[model samples]
Target: LTIKTKMLVYKACVLRRANLPSVTALLKQKRLRWLGHLSRLEDGRIPKDMLHGELSEGIRTIGRPKLRYKDTLKAFGIDPDQWETLAGDQNRWRQYLHQGIKVHDRNWLQRLQEKRVCGKQAAPESPNHDTYACNHGHGSCKSRIGLFSHMRHCKP
Candidate 1:
């Protein structure tokens, strides 16, 4: 069996063992795998996020809600113009993927919308201390802040 098929089966077994929703097993696996793959891409962006099983099974799953290609491309940091040919021609969609454009995280948008409507706590309020530090003694240091303020008088 192909890796995709194997992954689906494995996920099915896991979900069955866990007593979760086995009917949507394959769909959940596909979405998770897509996100995992995107996180590893060179561009640091997600791929074109499709409605779970849309293009995976093609015409057989035609009734699935397909995402807007333009929005998908934007989420992945790809210029929509770069996918102009694919955007305009349905026949070229698969070919356009050969050019290395990625889909967005399909579940992410849905979750964001749900959070908004349900008034749930959305994003984390805290920042990563290592990345956004004030440039000094570490851990959002006050020393760094004093240094930054003292540096304003120095000429380049």
Candidate 2:
């Protein structure tokens, strides 16, 4: 089966179906999970410092800038600076992950709602309606918030 079909089967959206986690989000969760596993390891056994440490030895080429591991952590609402301490508490770390990862739709809804309230409308297919691009990229659609909502399920 195709990636889209698999994802649709795996995830369930609140208002609609097909809303799966983005690649970046899934990766962040995986890394956080690894951090949680690493926290349980004894010091010096698996290079604990290295796993929890930041390496800033080399210079990166200038441009749009690459996504760093630290960047993903920050994106997932984690503060890398004190991540060691935070991860020490397994329950706390798990709670944070659960809350952060589960709120993607809510976040998008908040963005779209705020836009509507401010009269900052998305380009609609009709004068009174909005068109969301297809998640499968087949074409555009006229489903009001589908434009904003399809973002989570859109395939690259």
Candidate 3:
């Protein structure tokens, strides 16, 4: 797509036509799959240990805390308290994962559509190029860009 292409437009047209999942969705799927794999691993395995490990030292610097893997799982619609139980059964976990992904994608698309609609509703009307003028009343402008440039320096 060209640099001038709107991201929302590109996502709706190109990605839908190509039947591709969004990069974020793919990453979420991979992470959840790995999490499920780790969940089923035998106890004392390094990966499993690390997945369940907690920091014992080093005080947090403060501001906002870093995001944890569990946060992503929650974002994927899994409850942190019950994720281990859910992941214990491979078949159930697989089904749950697919359903979660579908729900997440649908919600994401709905939000995007809402954003596009709200953006269109809130946008200012375009000025007529032939008679465009700065709000500060510098003079008439030949184009939208010229009007913006003039507005920058045309102080009231």
Predicted structure 3: lDDT: 0.79
lDDT of 2 by residue, 71-118 (tens): 656666778788778788899988877765656445555665776677
Q: lDDT for model 2, on a 0 to 1 scale?
A: 0.66
lDDT of each: 0.44, 0.66, 0.79
Model 1 RMSD to the real structure?
19.7
TM-score of each: 0.19, 0.47, 0.64
Query: Judged by lDDT relative to the true structure, which candidate is superior, 2 or 3?
Result: 3
- Please write out the lDDT profile of model 1 over residues 51-87, one tens digit for every residue: 2235545354558676554454555444666544334
Tens-digit lDDT track for model 3 on 1-156?
Answer: 343444555465665776666677778878888999999999999999998888999888869988776877776788988988998999988888777777677777888999878977866877666687777666788887778788878889
> How accurate locally is residue 102 in candidate 1, as Cα lDDT from 0 to 100?
23
As a whole number from 0 to 100, the lDDT of residue 17 in candidate 2 is 43
- In model 2, how large is the Cα lDDT of residue 10? 25
Clash count, candidate 1: 7
Ordered by lDDT, highest first, the candidates read 3, 2, 1
